[model samples]
Target: MKGETEGRFHTPDVSSITPGPRRATLRTADGVRIEAVHDPCAKGPADTAIVVAHGFTGAATKPAVRRAAGVFAQYAAVITFSFRGHGKSGGRSTVGDREVLDLAAAVEWARSLGYERVVTVGFSMGGSVVLRHAATHRGSGRGRTEAVAAVSAPARWYYRGTPAMRRVHWLVTRRTGRLVSRLGFATRIHTKDWDPVPLSPVEAVPLIAPTPLLIVHGDRDPYFPVDHPLMLAAAGPAQLWLEEGMGHAENAAGDALLGRIGDWLIAARPAA
Candidate 1:
């Protein structure tokens, strides 16, 4: 890992003494290569690290994504990666269904680095990936996550309500949309429909019980309504944070909010 010096610090600010981020390329179980970066923990008691999964069309190098790593470095180690079909990662995105493998790869990478505890934090579409990943891997007895946090995630799938969502739907549902995605977002996503139907966020939440979960949603989010977070909170053991005027992920995630998430990851680590 590279050495870390400057970044916004939270309560622990442990990352002030930590090393800079280390860059690596990882392969998923399905053999898709994912571009990843790791930030080691600062000199302190916390041995926990965070694995960050970015939202749709977002890469590990986005300004907001990079900023999150800097802010999170204050409290603990962090690993941020681009999902398949985004950035330099290989393979097309199956949206929420097959993205679980992307997260699984990152979690395994964190364990290989000797982190005693790993918490996964995802935003928007990434939020759903973390949820399904946790549920799908729970009790598998291998590389299980210690905690999970979902920000501004949708509870259900195939939502087409808002104008933003409608545009997004077009991107996922039409062939022309796929071309636009490749040109604009550098993401190549599946154009077909889900056959067997993947587990929605709410359906997966129950399976993740006992694993500490934090659900943070903005009340003013234009993508998903408040009911999404409310439904998720009711389905599982989760601490819900309803921001007064939060928008979407990344750009909408301020430094203070990012630091708070760092605090939660630190606090959620398994007790010694």
Candidate 2:
């Protein structure tokens, strides 16, 4: 639904609600040490845990990420982490290619925390990771998600349809850009390209059927147009929300939008 609009909702401030102690370092199957944090629900004890995956150059500690987590904590226990090469985590980012392993580690850790159900919410680069993670671990219990929400995710890889994406391409593909990313953004980029080009998000979405899926995108997103979310919605039974006046990713997400997402997570159920 190109140009479709939704009512705007203002985000609430929850900066005073600090996240709980940092979790122990998580070890990915690929051996990356992922840093994570857990925030108990503000409403009360909950059986579910929401794992948040941040976009490129974003870490669990970023203000935007923390703000989102604070909002989510009102629904369920929240888990937020940095992918490899972002924040204090080890190794370099393969962008979204190998980040699924990072997500898996986070999901598994959440499960270990005694939560009966674990769902994932990811933004931008993180959005692609959650989609691929759900598909990749569909058959496995360790990382299989109960529900998945991908916000502002690309349907396919190598998308340079917009100038923001073109700039992102430069950040990942060029050494000078990588340096800038490290110094300015504190995100490290891998020097190599995807060898086999892992499963794209559109290809992964269909595989996530039976697992409740929600694809949320802003009509005014600069990185990816509505086509991205539309392609994802068309690929599977995902519920799509083409929000009006919204920008992109966590930064653009309002507390009202995040509250709706948390409400969805609370209501969503996996297929029997």
Q: What overall lDDT goes with each candidate model?
A: 0.83, 0.88
| Residue-by-residue lDDT tens digits, candidate 1, 49-158 | 89998999999999889898888888888889999989988899888788898888888777666677888999999999999988888764445898899998999999
Among residues 3 or more apart in sequence or in different chains, the pairs in candidate 2 whose N, CA or C atoms overlap within 3 Å are: 11-255
Over all chains combined, what TM-score does candidate 2 have?
0.92
lDDT of 2 at 96: 94
Q: What is the TM-score of each candidate against the true structure?
A: 0.90, 0.92
Query: Residue 62 error for model 2, in Å?
Result: 0.2
Instruction: Give the least accurate 10-residue stretch of model 2, judged by summed lDDT.
Output: 1-10
The residue-by-residue lDDT of candidate 2 on 81-160, one tens digit each, is 99999999999999998899989888877776678889999999999999999888886597888999999999999999
Error of 1 at 160 (Å): 0.7
